[model samples]
Target: MSLSRTLTRRQTLLAGLASGVMLARPRIASAAPTEFVMGVNGGAAYRNLYNNVLRHFEARHNAKVVPVFGSGSELLNRVLAERSRPTMDCFVTFQGAWLVGKAEGVLEKVDYNKIPHIDDVHDFLKDPDGYAPFVNFGAWGIVYNKDTVRTPPRSFKALWDRAYDRKVMLGGVYHWQIHLAAFAYAWTGDQKNIDVAFDKVKELAPRLAGLYGLSSDTQSKFQQGIADIAPWYSYTAQRVRQLGVPVAFQMPEEGGFLYPSAYHAVKGTQKVELVEKLIGTFYDPELQPGLAREDGFIPSNKKTVLPAAVAAELPTMEEVQRCHHWDWALINRDEGAWLNRWNAEVRRLVRG
Candidate 1:
């Protein structure tokens, strides 16, 4: 099945499950409640964390959460389509998509008064204008099998080495922009110019074992020893390691990419109070560490203390300082033109 069809099927299945839960509950005397539909990433790791939060919110507020899962872009499209009569009460997406939602005026400005927990979040993680506030973040860096690569790679340049030919796996086209930005900075000391990055990627194409569109594909490659190294978010790397895959994560010496997962209230949502409660629950210091532990995310709640092991696995403050934060607004604006250039120039040059 096509990816879209597969995602639609998954969403249907999950929605059915949510419906079942609602039906199973016995009706009791209480005020009429609202059903808050949240759009979130359709990945197992993300669902695990969100589900936990959902359970707690449901119990406390007596409201049902109907989760709609899809890719960030896909969810954004849904929000736009439903702008006349929005269905999604809130959206959980990455920084780039959040910017797009803000630019499109599909997101509601967050009101801090409703979510007192907002004060506990580190200032860096808070959206200055409060359109989308980051709940958790993870660093993007290199993942490698320790058994295969005795010498750990400390830089993005390692992916270009001829010695690892046909042993490297890269993220698919959609994710290449981040890699391109990293390469642009590493090669030309300019993150905005992609010319250098494109040339470098074309050079490394012959060495690539494969390009993965999903986390499962990347994990399978590592499991089968078909790939020795790849680029991925720290949460994924941590999950793979937990599965005893002989994998290790390294923040490249040049630095890494900081990818923040944020939440936005849909512009026309009627459950503003409920949405605030959900967002508050997501960033609650009591729940933040557990959510972070589920996926190795760095909690944006400054007061949430992580376990020693979880803390060790995350990017240190110094490492975070070295990481690159893209001009997402600019990238989102030019994404189409960039994708066109990539397909016509870089992708066509790939070997096999």
Candidate 2:
């Protein structure tokens, strides 16, 4: 419980207060279908959210799901900014962002019994605290242009090589978690020591091509040959290649971090049971593996059985162990300062 980071974001809340007041209605008088907005990551993965997850839930519940998509960080800002009355009933976003939302007091816990399929989740991925229900995961590592570099990057450390000068696209300010994990792993062998990580970032500053905030932006950079490499997630790498970009992913020998995708209810949302149930739809054993085949991420459900082709392609969870797993509470406490340091010391030095 760090002091709430969202208390000062009242300006954003004020701006939306009038609209929320006008639209916030009691579901008392009717049995009409409920309409709720879901905030999620934008870009290629929208396919899985729509085709595999959303539509089915909507059909069964007679509800209308409107999706508001953005990068995980952007969605986090929205959750905190609208703390008193969130416009999005629930957000399907990343673990670190969810940690911040929970700390900021904008997130609501799901009653485990309410989400039926939650029991199907692997014990290792379940959140004992109940705020973030991580449904999918992917490997975060280096992705390189296969056409230009015949030698696939074998280590995260390769990003700093002089040969990659002005040819690397790193995550933007919003993606502070990955940038920290990357630089720390590159220099200090783990993500816990920020002092060492900051030093590594300053050293790599000279070689950066630019910073990107979205999957679409990353794909365009690789496709147009604007950058030949980036520290990115495997699911994003797979989506980029599917769009005709020639790239390949590798979990460096030191290991890569896990990108866990989670969904949590907004504190003031009127549709509590509905929101949790919708999230539960993603856990259906038959639908969970589609996260692997279609969205390019590993499923979190213990009962999910991936097809042979997908099983062969994805890296084993064991491959992601070199770095220390991130702890949610500590991350919430330190994330803001990390972003501030990145902007002041690292972002200012790099040129696109």
Candidate 3:
């Protein structure tokens, strides 16, 4: 399908109301309420964490939490669509989504005084104005079926190798592709250096099995023996293992990109106190540690202790610290141009 046609259809259904939408009116209350809603990534384990740890606070405060599960983008666009109506009280998303939301004026500054745990969080995670605070760090790399490919690809170069032609795959529709493209460019020390990145991809074109639409597609393809390698999030590596799939997740020797998910209060949300309470709950040492253990994300607050097994398996703080960082702000500021150029160049290489 044509790109414009696809976007127009998405816009009509999901692009959300333009900036012209009126602001929502905050609900008034004499004191803290007993009920608040939170939007989070959809998953059973995450839901369990909220029910076991965070809900304890709500019970202590005589309040209740309602969770609306979605991806970061889904939550952001939903909040944006309901800008005038304010359907969500607190929205949890990645740093990129939160920054974009803050820039769009859809988020409200969190009062640091209210969330005492703010003091425990690392400086890099907290926004100056407190509009959104990061919850955890995540890395991007390759996930492959260990049983299928004995000599796994060590780096991005392996994905393009002639030996693996028509056996490689990647999650192309989601943000992993964005991060991979960004990483490819960043590795060249040229954020806008599409030519180099495209050259790399073109070299791998002969090995391309197909582009996938979802993370599950990558996992599924690998399990069915359709793909030999797929680029994915570090967290997914653990989840894939839990599913009884013998998968090997690798961080390229050249280093991979990392991103963080954040929590933000929607502007004019009625339950400000409730939102603050929920955000504060996220930083609770007790909760943060469990989140890290269960979700496979590095905790935002350094105080949270990860399980020994999990810590041993995942990348260390020092290792994460050593990798080069991609400038997410620049990417957010110019994603359209980058994607456009990426598409054109990739198509040129593929068409050849």
Candidate 4:
């Protein structure tokens, strides 16, 4: 890792932190309800967390827990569209998306009093004003076929290196690459770094074997020997390797960003306390090990121990902290325009 590069990114994050953007919470929370609904994104990690840990919470509290699964973007939009008459009490979201929703005033503030586990949560999970809180922390890494990636790309830049020509795959129509471009630019002090990153993407695009919108698609491609590498969350990378595909995951010396999926209480719901309990239960220390082991996300609660498996799958916390933090405020302010630019300029260049 380049110390100079790492320092530059930290400086940018510090500048954003100094801006004092007030912590924004969801717009409303309903009164306590007997039965509550939760929005979830599918697959094993989500299923284990919801079906196993969450079911335990329900049994203990003697309340009903309904799980509504969908794509991350779809579920978040559902919450926003139903803001006036919230159909779901709480929705799970990736930190990046959750931060965007919080800025848009779609999430409700959590009541810590009803849920004491707030105290166990790390400082990063708790907004200064106590609005959004993390349920789990996730990281992004590369997955490579052992036979194909004899010397896997060590950094994001490797994806663009001509050496891996026609052997690499990148996620498209998603925020992973977008955030990565932003991080790369922020680290290099390149105001136009996002575009630069996109240029790199275009350079490597022609050599790309495939583009995946789903984790399963990426995994299948690797298994079938169609493509050797894919950008994915650490959990997915871990699971893929376990399938005996001779896969290895990397956090890259450039460092990957930290993202946490959090519980957002929808405002104007009749399940405020129930929602709080649901959020709080995720922070329980006893539950963290199980979550980290089965789900592959770091429990947001500081008291939660990071299982060896989960820790092995992701970069060290210090390494994660080293990566450029995506200033959500800035991203929120410009993501639409940036995304539009990406679609028109970046994607067009790739297609050509």
TM-score of each: 0.86, 0.82, 0.80, 0.81
lDDT of 2 by residue, 1-352 (tens): 5446655568668858856765675443345778978888766688767888888888888799888987777888988888876799888767777767777788888777888678777665677887757877888888889998777668878777788888888888556666776667567765678788788878888678888767787888888888888888888877676677888888888777777878778888888888778868888888876777767777777688888987766766577445345555556678778888888998888878
Candidate achieving higher lDDT, 3 or 4:
4
| Sequence-dependent TM-score of model 3 | 0.80
Sequence-dependent TM-score of model 1? 0.86
Tens-place lDDT digits, model 4, residues 23-61:
332222322435878887767656677654787788777
Between candidates 2 and 4, which one is better according to lDDT? 2
Instruction: Give each prediction's root-mean-square deviation over alpha carbons.
Output: 12.0, 13.0, 14.7, 18.3
Where in model 2 is the C-alpha error above 4 Å? 1-32, 320-324, 327-332, 335-337
User: Arrange candidates by TM-score, highest first: which order?
Assistant: 1, 2, 4, 3
Per-residue error for 155 in candidate 1, Å, reads: 0.9
Residue pairs in steric clash, candidate 2? none
Clashing pairs in 3: 93-262, 94-261, 165-207, 166-207
Pairs of residues at least 3 apart in sequence or in different chains that clash in candidate 1: none
**Stretches of candidate 1 exceeding 4 Å from the true structure:** 1-33
Order of quality (lDDT) = 1, 2, 4, 3
lDDT, candidates in the order shown:
0.79, 0.77, 0.69, 0.69
Candidate number achieving the greatest TM-score relative to the actual structure:
1
Supply candidate 4's per-residue lDDT for 191.
Answer: 30
Report how far off residue 31 is in candidate 4 (Å): 19
